[model samples]
Each structure stands twice: as C-alpha cells, then as structure tokens.
Target chain A: MKKFVQVEDVGMRFDTKKGPFVALRDVDLAIEKGEFIALIGHSGCGKSTLLNLIAGLTVPTDGVLICDGREIAGPGPEREVVFQNHSLLPWLTCFENVYLAVERVFGAKEGKPKLKLRTQEALALVGLTHAEQKYPHEISGGMKQRVGIARALSMQPKVLLMDEPFGALDALTRARLQDELMKICDATGATVVMVTHDVDEAVLLSDRIVMMTNGPAATIGEILKVELPRPRNRLELAHDPRYIDYRAAVLSFLYEKQAHHEKQAA
Target chain B: MSAITFEKALEAGAAAAVAEPAVVAVARSEPAASAASTASVASSAVPVARDGGAPSPKPESRAGEWLRAAARATLPPAIGLAVMIGIWYLATLSAGGSLPGPVQTWEAAVKLFADPFYSNGPNDQGIGWNVLSSLQRVGIGFGIAALIGIPLGFLLGRFATLSSMVNPIISLLRPVSPLAWLPIGLLVFKKADPAATWTIFICSIWPMIMNTAQGVTRVPSDYMNVARVLNLSEWKIFTKILFPAVLPYMLTGIRLSIGTAWLVIVAAEMLTGGVGIGFWVWDEWNNLKVEHIIIAIFVIGIVGLLLEQMLIAIAKRFSYE
Candidate 1:
C-alpha cells in the first residue's frame, strides 16, 4: 500500500512549570492511502498531539511529518480535521458551515462557481438536507458531528482527521454514528486518522489500530492490522472472530500497561 | 390534620396526584390555608388532578401569575422612585431659592428645547449645538479607538507569548485616569478640541482593546481546532470564526469604551473650555445658572442612555442564538 500520511520520528514537548513534559516521543507511523487508521490509548497518551502534528496544527519538537510525499508545514485543504467537539461555528447554519469550507477551498480559487452545489452534495452525504438551515445549537450532538464530517468532506481532503468525534455522544447514539462514519468512509475513499477510546469502535471502523504508551514521553506501542472485511456492520463486526481477537488483544495491552503503571507508582 | 400531619398529607397528596386516576380525598383533616395551598400545589404537581377535584390554578392563571410575578419583581423600584421624587419635592419645598423641583427641571428642559437651536450672536449657542458637539467628539474618539483596538486585540489574542508579555504594560497604563492623560494630550496636540478628543480616545480605547483581546483569546479552542482540521486559511479563521466569536465581547467593550469616552470628553471639555455638553454644563455652573446646569445634566444622561441602547441593539443583532 502506498504511504499517504507519514510521521517520521516526530517528537513534541511542552515547557511546564514543573519541568519539560514530553507529549510525544519518537513517534513514527505511515498510513496507507485510503486506509482507516485508529490511534487509541489512555487520555494524555499524546494521541491528540500526534493527530495535531499530522494536521500540521503544531510543529514537532524534532523530526518531520510528510503528507503525499511533501513536507507538512501547516494546515491545508488536503488534510481536513473533524474535532472531537464537532466545532461547528455556532453562528452558522449547517449548510453555511459546510459551504464556508467549500467556499474557502474552491470558491476563492479561480473559475469555481460550482462550489455551492458541491457543498449541498456534501451536506446531503451526511444526511443533513432537511437541517441545512439549522444552527449548530439547534441541532442534536450526533447531528453536529455529522455537520463536522460534512464540512471536512466538503473540502475533498486527501486525509480526514477525526479527534474522538463520537466520544461525547451517548452509547447508542455513538454506535449509530460510528456505523454511519464507516459507510461514509467507504464512499469517500479518503484516508482517515481517527483518535478514539472505544476498542470496538476502532476495530469496527479501522483497517489498523495504532496503540500508544501512556505519556510523559509517549510512543507507539503497537500497530495491529484489523483483517475485517469492508462495508462493516457494527452488529456483525462485533460477532466476527477477528473482531473479538483484536478487542481481546487491545484490552490486554491496556490492562498490562495499567499494571505496569501501578508498579511504577509503588 | 395537625401541622406535621398536614405537611405529610401534602407530600402524600403530591405522590397520589401523579399516580391516582380519580379524586384524591384531601384528608379534609388539614387547615383551610393548608388546603388552599395544597390545592394550588396540586394544580402544579398533578398536571391533571385525578379526580379533577381542585380547580386547576385558574385557566387565565399563568397570565395572572406571570403578571403578579412581574409586579412583585418591579414594584419595589417603582415605589422607590416615587418615594425619592416625593422626598425631593419636600426638600425643595422646605428650602426655596431658585432650587428647582422636578417640575422646574422639566420646564427648564422644555424651555431649552423650545428654542431648539439658538445663536443670540457670536459666543452663544443653544444646547442642541452643545449636544451635537459632544456627540461628534464621542463619535470621532470612539471611531479612532475601535479602529485601532480591534486589530491590536486580534494580534494580542492570536499570539500568546506576545499577549503575556504585553499584559503587564497594558495593566500599568490602564488605571491611569483620563484626566492624567488630558494634560499629556493637551501638551502634545497644543489645542483644546483635539486634546480633549484625544483624551476621550485614550480613555475609551482601553476597554475595547482589553475586551477584544479577551474575546479573541476565549474564541473556543474547539473553533480553532476546527480551523486547523478543515485547513482553513488564516484569513478565513479570522473573518469567519474569530471575528464572530469575539463580536459580543468586543461590542460590550465598545459600549463600555464609549461610555468612558463620553465621561472623559465632558471632563476634558470642562478643563479645556469648548463647545460640548461638558462645556455647557461647566459654563452654566460658572454663570451660576443652576436650572441650566440641571437641564444639561438631564440632557447628558438621556444622550448617554440612547448611546448605550444603540450599542446594546447592535450587540443583540450580532449575538449567536
């Protein structure tokens, strides 16, 4: 598989009142083109820091990140991010939110009047045709997340970065949205780099799950390839043998890490 | 029912109100007041009283309750104002000179406006011109402050280290009174009107600058992250995201700043001796025209109120949700 997003020995640190806190350490990961990759670990395990690095929101303390064989210097239209909070501009309606991105990417460029239609199509893809006129505050949490997805997809990005997009949702709502996300991914063929805590969600949606060690100095502990077939059904995916095995492996890895952490504390 | 028993009974009644299908036998065992209160309580708790026993708290009820609630809330201030007016009348009656009562003040206001615009020749202009001059100075000073404050606020908001570094300097300069800046402004400009206006601008700009910076900094981290994720250009993030998010705060700042401008301009005008409401008040005081001074005070207050309302309307228009 062709490597589409590469983080080459990237490290990130923050100078704190106590001392220098390492957010990420020597993190190297290559995402194949069109692959759904999940970066999973405990809170503050640098999963988000790594995602931000990939999104070019922040510079790495050391090393480089490459996207489509070019150095990733800053945010661009090609790598759109869907934040955990959905981050829909409160003042903008759902359609306007998506259209804003579409307009910025295509409308501002030379000779592009069809951007409006593309925005509508993207909103429709996220099943928000009827809600195009509604503001973010007027919508449900799940719908807001959908708008976030629509806005990102509207850019026609090469890589879609989701930072725990469903983490705030209720369990049932989260599951339904996860299923919707998987279908959207199948259709878009855009490579996804999502950070999530739910093991089942990661397994069900991703082609590979990258687990990181706990931070202070976080690093990638394992990158397990999920062999589940495409067009995944949440119910059927959970029942599948490979899905169960992946879940067990991830859970055990987390448990062993927790035990190691306790020992270190003692 | 005894007092304790009545309390238990109301609780029991409330519980029964939700569950029972028909009339709840009010343990007629309670006091009349308790019964009435309980029945009213049932109107709230039952939603639909099982037996339809008690009259629902009146069908014209909510409106009546709302009116009563509003009256209860507003009555104190209304009474207080009336009492204050009465006391002022009594005080004026007790000590008479040309000491104006509310009626005298009203007459003075009317007399001032009745002529509207006056020029008894050079060296004389009616309050209309005075008010116009004051408003013009406020507009110019406020405009200058806003033009500079907003951009500086955005810069301070966007750059964290710069904001932290500049915070001390801003703090140190912020508390020094406009009166203090007045002399410096007068010295620099070497003219009264420009100096007075500059003092107004200097005084007013701080709130707008601080509020704008605060608004910018507080532009939800989620929004910035969205900007990053979507790969929105810096310009889009500023115009679309940061601008709207911080607008309410900036508007509030502007509102506060304008008030400060009005305050400082009046003081500056008093010191510098010019054509403004402040100068009119000071000039009337100098002439010992107490009635005219009272009229000028009223005019200043009314104008300030209108200005604040205008700003509030703008803030409301731009408010999200």
Candidate 2:
C-alpha cells in the first residue's frame, strides 16, 4: 500500500544575502497513519525546515511531498501545524482561538452550535475547559501551547505537524505535556510528526525517532523504532533497559557520530 | 494622639506580661518596676508592641491615607495654576493695563459664558457658538480625512509598490504648512468655510495615513501565518486579524490627526474670517477685547485637552495587552 504521507528525495535550499544556503538534501521519509514520529537533532539541523516543507508552510527546492495521494502545495486544514511559540492570537480567548480553526474547517457544512461544541470538545480534550474565556496572555505558557495543540487537533487534520511543541516549556511541564500528548495520540489515533531535541521526550512519545545529522545539509542519519510498550509510564521507563537502549542509540547518533564541532569550539 | 500612643503602650505591656509572667508582676507595679524588669521588657516588648499597634490604627490611618493621596494628586497642579495666575497678575501690573490680568480674564469668561449661545448675526455670535462652529469644522474635516486616509493607509501598507510610489509625495506635502493649502482650497471650493475645512483636512490626513500604515505593516507575522494556515478569506483575514490588530494604531493616528485638525482649525479660521473660535479671537483683538481673547486661549487649550483625553480613553478600551 502507498504511504500515508511521503517525503521522497526532498531537498530544501534557502536563498540568503550571502549565497544559497543548503538546509537539507536527499531527505526521504514515509509516515504511516496513526504513527507518532519524532524528528530529533541538534539546533540548526533543519529538522523544522523539513517539517515545514511537509506542512507546506514552505516549499522545497527539490522533490515532491504527497499526503494521502495528493501533492503538498501549501498549508491547508488537512495538515495542521502547531508552531513552537504556540502562536495563539493574543486578542482571542482560548476557546475563540480553537474555534477559529474549527470554523474554518467545518463552518461551511456545520452550524454555529456544532462549531461551538467542537471548540469546547477540543479544549476539553486538552483539559482547558475552565480557561475557555481567558485570553492567551492570561493563561500559562504550557496552557497556551495546549491551546495551540487543541487548535490543530480540532481541525481533525490527516497529519499533525509540530515543531518543538514542548521545547519552550519547563522540564516538569514538558514531561507532563509529553505524557498528556501520548494519551491524546492514543485516544485519537493521530498521525503526528513532531520535531524535538530532548532524547527522553523522543523515547517516551514517539513510535519512531528519526535522528538527523548536523547541517549545512542535514539528512536522516538513522531511524530507531521505539519498541517500548504503551501505555508507557515515565516512572517505570526510568529503569526500563529497552527504553534506555533506544534513547542511547539516538544519543550516540546525535553526539558521537553527528557531534556539532562549532558548538564544542564555542 | 498622646492618648492613642498611651493606649498602644498599655497593649504592649499586656502582651509582654503574657510572654513573661515576671513582667506581669512588673506591669502590676507599673512605675515601681526594677531595672532588670525594664531591660527584659525592652528586649521582649518591641515586636509584641508592633503587632499590638498595627491592627487598631489601620482603619483610621486608611481614611487618612486616602485623604493624603488625594492631596498628593491635586496639590501640584493647583500650585502650578496659582503660580501661573500670579505671574499673569504681575505681568498685567507691569504692562499698565494694556493686557488683562487673571481676574479680568475670569470675570470676562463668566460674563461671556452667561450668554454663550446667543447669535445676533453670523459674525456677531456668542463664544459658545464660535467654539462649536470651530469644532464642527474640525469634525467634518477630520471625518473626511479618516474616511479616505485610513483605507489608503491599509492599501499602502498591504502593497509595498503602492507605498513606494505614494510615500515620496506624502513626505513632500506633509511638511508644507496647512495655511499654505488655503489658497489652493480657496481656488477649488471658492468659499471660506469649506476652504478652512480643507486646510484642516490636509493637515490632519498625514498622521492618520502614516500611522495606520505603520500599524498595518507592524502586525505580527505569526498572526499572518495563522491567517494563511486557516485559509481565511480576505474578508475574514481583514476582520479577524488585520482590523483588530490595527485598531490601537488607528486610534493613535486619529488622536494625532484630531490634534492637528484642532490646531489647524484655529489658524485656518483666523485667516478665513468665519464663525469660529479663531475668528472670534481675531475679532476680539480687533475690538480691543483682550480679555475675551485670553478667555478664547483658555477655551482652546481646554477643548484640545478634552479631545486628546477622549481619544486616549477610546484607545485604552481597545488595547489587548
């Protein structure tokens, strides 16, 4: 069967003031339906660049991205992106923020009441029902990110694209959100492509951890399948040998093989 | 006050007695207490005294605090005004009655305001009519400017090419005095009233256009990204994203434009010779009613202040963060 989402021999080159910057080259991946995938790398590794290409936020210089038998031309409701900064419109309440996405996706067919129900349902899914009337500034950073997640999920996208969704959160908040996300994915059976730097986050949340080498032309260095059984618990996984092995493999690939030389010198 | 302090001292003594049973004996004895009792009392009584003193004085002090705060807010401006009036009085004394003093101006203001809206002829109207007419001209002129300038600003901000083409012309025209446009206004409309309004319009439009454009351009890219990802229609993008985002900037522009409009209306009406506060000022000067001119200055200042404050209040209402 054809892949649910395909990135076949994709390359991305950005035109900068100095010269053409090769961000990624010969990148290839296939994401199956209901799979939670994590793209892990050091900073400036173009993992986000690749995710943007898949979301069609930016176009690739070469190769075609197909989602469910259609070419990825530009951003649409079918593939929703949860930006790193949470990008909730500050003027809008949490409910209104999610409602905007819901209205756009389903407003033509659904009435206002149904749209309202969907918005409430999405916020409820993220356990932010109490904060429905609070604006983005009024809520905590983690809550804002959850609102962003709710907005993406509310659209019922074919693939959910996240660019370090929990990267800005505190360590404890990040862990709690990761577990919540795992539960969310398990409940919804969502096809997710998350870009993350934390090793344990990759091990805890993803079905497959796609390790990326350092740029100027970052590509997939290795892909490790997380064989840890779910419903995964972080406390239990702290001593789980297999979970440790998967994390170590990703760490070795990132640090030993693809160690950032410039960072060490700095 | 001494009674209150004595009461606080008694409360402290009671608290000290509770902390040390030996102090209770010393407290009962009062003035006959020993030096050892006094030393122990000094060490232990301080914190307990503070705790006992705090609660009782709070209710009375809070009322006093509010009065003090009110005085703090009002005193400086009052003093400044008194000093200004005194200077005016001194200046009038030195000028040997050619200029009006604060008292003369106040008396004239009271008399003028007593029959403010009376009108015998178009030129012979009350100060209220004059001020209202000036405000009307500013309103009409500013209204027209807003209707045109705001939309143009959005277009200019949205389209870089249009902005490039228009910005040089705005830069050239904006610096020219509003009165300089009066001849052009006179030439086109062939009437004094509309010409004065035209000057107000020309003077006010620049800030609105410039500020609104700046506001539009400065809208956060994240919001635009949200718009694009949602595939929002242009109308939806405008209403949901652009309009609300640009509102504060637009209000700021309106505030600035109204100030310019008010400023220009005075000068414009002074030249145009019509039923306005500026014309009234000139007419009063011609009739040697210097006190009336002084009143007009205060009126103009007060009206300008009120206009700015109104806009600021509206701007505050729309601000999100």
TM-score of chain B of each: 0.75, 0.82
lDDT of each residue in B1-321, candidate 1, tens digit only: 122333344444435544653233222212332444444434543443323434566645654565456555644554444344444444454466567765566667777889868876534788898889889988998899899988888889888998999889989999999889888887899998888888888888899889999998898888877777666678888888999999999999999998888877788888887778888888888888788987787788888899999999999999986
* Model 2 TM-score relative to the real fold: 0.88
Model 2: residues with Cα > 4 Å off, grouped in runs: A264-266, B1-58
Which pairs of residues collide in model 1?
A81-B229, B1-B29, B22-B51, B23-B51
- Name the regions of candidate 1 deviating beyond 4 angstroms: A108-112, A262-266, B1-74, B93-98, B122-124, B155-173, B180-191
Query: Candidate 1 has what TM-score?
Result: 0.81
Among all candidates shown, the one with the greatest DockQ: 2
Worst 10 residues of 2 chain A by lDDT: A257-266
lDDT of 2: 0.86
Give the per-residue lDDT digits (tens) of candidate 1, residues A141-174. Answer: 9999999999999989999999999999999989
List lDDT for all candidates, in order.
0.81, 0.86
